[model samples]
Target: MTNTRSRGAASRGGWIRQYHHPRGDAPTLVCFPHAGGSASAYFALSAALSEGAEALIVQYPGRQDRLDEPALKDLGELADGVVAALAPWTGRPLTLFGHSMGSVVAYEVARRLERGPGPGPAGLVVSGNMAPSVQRDQGVHLMNDEELMTWMSDLAGTPPAVLADKELLATIAPALRADFTALETYRHPEGSSVECPISGYVGDHDPHVPHDGFLRWAEHTKAEFTVQVFEGGHFYIEDQVQDVARSILRDLSAFVSRRLARHPLA
Candidate 1:
């Protein structure tokens, strides 16, 4: 496996980012970042799993290299863009992992893929988000700049340095607002569920979603469902990257095993 990070023009796709090269035979783990986060957010996890899985992080518009592009304000549109952009990499087994708002996006993408002719993701790992069915209308998108920054501070998702720097906060506010809008306004239709196994993770002390809320994800998956509780808050993965990577790899391995059992000749 080749380990390298590329952010040059050649690496700039509207959606996917492959920071490291893994074995062709390795399963692909497609990661969706939390709201206001860029693909670079998953760089460490990508590096950690470089040998076991090909990690492809989604880069939504209005951030990083795609800064010039308009940010999507609807979850459906975001999921559509991701599903289409994933065309070339669907040949191998795929496991979708998403955090915060990205969890719903990953669920939607998995639903779309299963509805299509191709096979759906082998499994889904949702972190720091409640099941889509549990709707909460948080008006974070409607907050003014000051309020928005304050909210981000309370959640501890944004760094103190970034929160304190007005100039930097202003730069990312648009994308952040757009993401909030998409998340707040989105609703998952009743009975909408995925065929893939779903694994949920959440920090024990997360302010946004409680442990029970995380377990509600079981309702959205027809297959096996499991949950892992970690220490800290919503951004727990920030401190537990290695443990998270190990859990993800274990899920990916199980997915592969299940896939092989279904089609042993493959």
Candidate 2:
């Protein structure tokens, strides 16, 4: 629910990274990042959470410090690695938050945790992505590396500093393409959708995922359901982080209050 002084790392060849604010009293909030993104994506998010929670963000490999790592081409491979890597943190009433490609990954993580030998997540937050059940992917992942980078450039908001260099873009292209493939081609395991409280966040103007795609999440979580629109694009989670952070904090607060009322943390 919360972070203190915790630390996190993933296999250099793996597809996830992590950060921990180590503290036992705070609830643990596990975050998954967008495609071509690392845990650093949520660094500012910690400040937005309630004081009673710590943030543990997942760093999808293939970018930032793990740039040398071979990025994962399969969404399941990434999700499996994520669930396995964070095995130690699955205890207690955990909350999972995912944005963009992260939203799907978080949903998958929730599914994995449900199937795992542990308590399911107390709350679920999905942002900037369409529901996994209904996809309109045109097989952009099948695009050659050059086209993939162009697609990512047109779609994602990877820092300009990184995108400006041809050599750097060359290095990052495969992973970006892989991320697109992972999102585009991934199929939810047969009949596995979570029944936890789910809140959906979307960019008011994101073209990649539309309202209809987000509505499909209703078939998944049986707990309380919600959907909110923001004022940006596919990456609205970043473009309007403060507003998004406030919304997230609000939901996290409600979850905490309800949880403490039902099962006080001693």
lDDT (CA) per prediction:
0.86, 0.74
Off by over 4 Å in 2: 1-24, 50-52, 259-266
Tens digit of per-residue lDDT, candidate 1, span 4-110? 33223216577888888676557778999999999999999898887788888999999988888999999999999999888765555579999999999999999
How do all models score by TM-score? 0.94, 0.86
| Model 1 lDDT-worst window of ten | 1-10
Error of 2 at 251 (Å): 1.4
Compared with the true structure, model 2 gives a TM-score of 0.86
> Per-residue lDDT for 3-103 in model 2, tens only?
22134343233433433343456666778887777777776676655354667677666777777777888888888888887776666667888988888
The segments of candidate 1 whose C-alpha lies over 4 angstroms from its true place after superposition are 1-12
| lDDT computed for candidate 1 | 0.86
Q: Tell me each candidate's RMSD, in Å, in order.
A: 2.9, 3.2
* Each model's backbone clash number: 0, 20
